[model samples]
Target: MKLHIVPARTGFQWVKLGAKTFFRQPLAMGGLFFMFMAAVSVLSLIPLLGTLISLALVPAATLGLMAASREAEQGRFPMPTLLVTAFRSGPANTRSILVLGAMYAAALMLVFGVGALLAPDVPAIEMPEGEVSPERVRAMFNNPGLWVALVLYVPVLMAFWHAPALVHWYGVSPFKSLFFSLMACWANKGAMLLYSLGWMAVIMMAGVVMNLLAVLLGGAALLNIVLYPMVLLLAAMFHTSIWFTVRDSFVTQEDRAA
Candidate 1:
């Protein structure tokens, strides 16, 4: 089959495809959730191990892409079995995905460290006789150097924005994956920015809701359990959307035409 790269689709279409693919495979989706829980559990036990295991997060993120690709390859999108076959076929692709993921993590950590260093010292919050002042909190937000660091790090952020999908869909080398992912972001800057912003909005809303629920429920653990699966689900969908975009934008039909 020839690999024809398509133009980036609308966010709604990408998200719809992701939801459809996820809901179609219960066991596979369950397995993906299990892997995420296992990673979280392991990380909670050992911080260093968690950092190492973090490399797999992108591969976990790409599970939907793997499932979708396998279904397409087999000429059948069977509901219950899609994820199983996807996992079987994912070893090589997952390795590539992890390689890109590790590179991205390293880059992000370096950027974040630099940002932290450049940021001004945060003042200690002193409670008044009764309540903390909002003005005091707002005053801490005034750091130009930190802002500069953030601006400089945008390229690194953009590089990783679609990396998992690039690896999963294209099975490209790490260098090529990084190159194409960033280039795709550059080519479709507006769409990519909107995608990033939308993801942030979802995450922020989820956080707010979960915090509120925690206050009402009296145990944040329940909130964590609920949010964990949802986070994994959203991560899976986001990576799948990127996979579709990369498959459409980077992998050429001619290259696979042979």
Candidate 2:
């Protein structure tokens, strides 16, 4: 049973690919999720450790992408242990994963840097020896720099949108992957832009609903519990979509034969 790369024509195609990919290797996918959660939780506890842990996430994620690509190519749906086994197999793949991860880290830093630059230089709120006014808080929200930051962050988000798939599955170097991924952004600009915007919109809407629920339910923790899995699932779907795109465009017949 040769794995065929299907053309993605609509949102349903992406969703189906995502769901099918997970269903084919539930145990492995589940294990990956658990490992990711455990790592995130542990990193969150240590001061400044979160940044270090964040660096690993891209590589780990790229590892998952590689695992999926290998499984798909072989037409075999192995269990979760396969992921661990694959990682232990060689140093070359590990290096590729780390390189891909570093690309993501660089993108994250760029995004943060842009945001920092665009953020307004507002003085810290001081207790003017009297009660604070609501108008002051409202004024903060209306800052032009804040709006610019929000607008500029969109492209940064889109830049590395398919990066994991590019490095993990395509076996491209970081520089090449970055080049092609950016080409992907421009070539499929409409679909890629819409995809990012659509996801962002969904996230924003979900955040609003969750925040409202949190206010009514008495805390955001419960909302987070529900949201975390949803976010992960979406992330998986996004990565899978990127895989489909890259596989169809860049992966050669010889590579698949190997």
Candidate 3:
């Protein structure tokens, strides 16, 4: 497969395509997303190995969502089994995906560890009257560890962005997939940045609209009731867009054959 650089504007197009495609099969896409979350949640409830296993399954789960997105884009109903696409591909590919997952988990742990070591200790906040003050909230946001973690996650995101698809479609090994994924993201960083910013704007707009409704409806409880599902839907839409990023950024041999 060959990496292709996309124009920055293509990021906005990806957002549009993802939202449009999601509407075409809202129930199926949304249900699959729910199933995805359920599976992760259940796995995470296990013992000590739970978190590790869940983290290890991330690449495969991500691949499944991408596959579902592809199916939905083609006007097909995506099955829950699509979530297992990575594991079912073949022994070699499955093992590679598993390795990729392990690598991702390890990378995340390392980043978290370093961030924790570098972060200053936050003083405990006193919650008088059983309510957190705005200062407490601000202190939470001001924690350097949180910022460090977010910053460190960027490279991990770049490395894994397309690694599963690369392995699935091109039979790239786990390490090579990470390298290629990183290169592809770096080569198309402008588009990626725009894509990220576009999503943030979409989410912010959603929050604003939801907040307005909460004001009209007269409660924070109503906001919570509506916001949870909306957040899930937006998350599903974002994951759905990931497939488009791969489609536009890479050229497989079959693409040339066509």
Candidate 4:
């Protein structure tokens, strides 16, 4: 596959195309995403190692969703089995993806470690044996540790943004995928800037709408009932956007059609 230097406006089109793909097979797409979440949740049940494994599987999971999007874009229902495309594509592709996943998991753990180093031992949560008291929960948000994690995550995110797509679709090796992905992102800096700003605007609008709903409905508690599903839909759309990023940045339209 070849990299395409799309104009700045092309960035906005990813989310637009993503919305169109989502509407095309909402049920199938939603079901598959929820299944993915459930699978991750199940994996997370395995104790400390479970969380690591879940993070590692991220790239593979993302590619599976992209594969599903391809089917949805073609007017076909995305089957659950499509999730294994990365694993079964070819031996080299499978190995490369697995290596990428392992690298992701390692990078995440390193980020968490750095956060711990940057944060001071300020406070601890205490309450019932099973859960933190409500006050403690609020205190955690005010803790500096949270900001440390958030700050360190930005660059980690930038590095992996296109790595999975490169490995899965372009047959790049694990280390090379990271470099090429970063370079591709750097090359499309203007478009990515617009894309980021556009999403921020949408997020602001969503927050405004949610708050208005809470006010009209007389309680923030009940608003969550409506907001949760909306959040999930937005999350799905974001993944769809990632798929389109891969398409627009790597494949020509005519090639994508074939």
Winner by lDDT: 3
Model 1 C-alpha lDDT per residue in residues 76-192, reported as the tens digit of each score = 543444333324455786566567667766776676678778777776777856454886657656765667678868887666665555555456676776676677778876555
Expressed as tens digits, the lDDT of each residue in 200-233 for candidate 3 is 9999999999999999997687887998899999
Least lDDT summed over 10 consecutive residues: which range in candidate 1?
1-10
TM-score of each: 0.63, 0.63, 0.94, 0.86
lDDT of 2 by residue, 187-258 (tens): 665554455565566568777888888888868577767777767765654454445444544546786788
* Model 2 steric clash pairs: 28-80
Off by over 4 Å in 3: 126-132
Cα RMSD (angstroms) for every candidate in the order listed: 5.9, 6.2, 1.8, 3.4
Q: State the displacement of the C-alpha of residue 7, model 4, in Å, after optimal TM-score superposition.
A: 1.5
- Segments in model 2 whose C-alpha atoms lie over 4 Å from true places: 1-12, 23-31, 69-78, 81-89, 121-159, 197-240, 254-258
lDDT of 2 at 14: 45
For 160-180, candidate 4 gives per-residue lDDT tens digits of 888887887777788988887
Superior by TM-score: candidate 2 or candidate 4: 4
lDDT of 2: 0.59
Instruction: Tell me the spans in candidate 1 whose CA falls farther than 4 Å from its real position.
Output: 1-9, 56-99, 123-153, 162-171, 197-233, 254-258
> Which of candidates 1 and 2 is the stronger one according to lDDT?
1
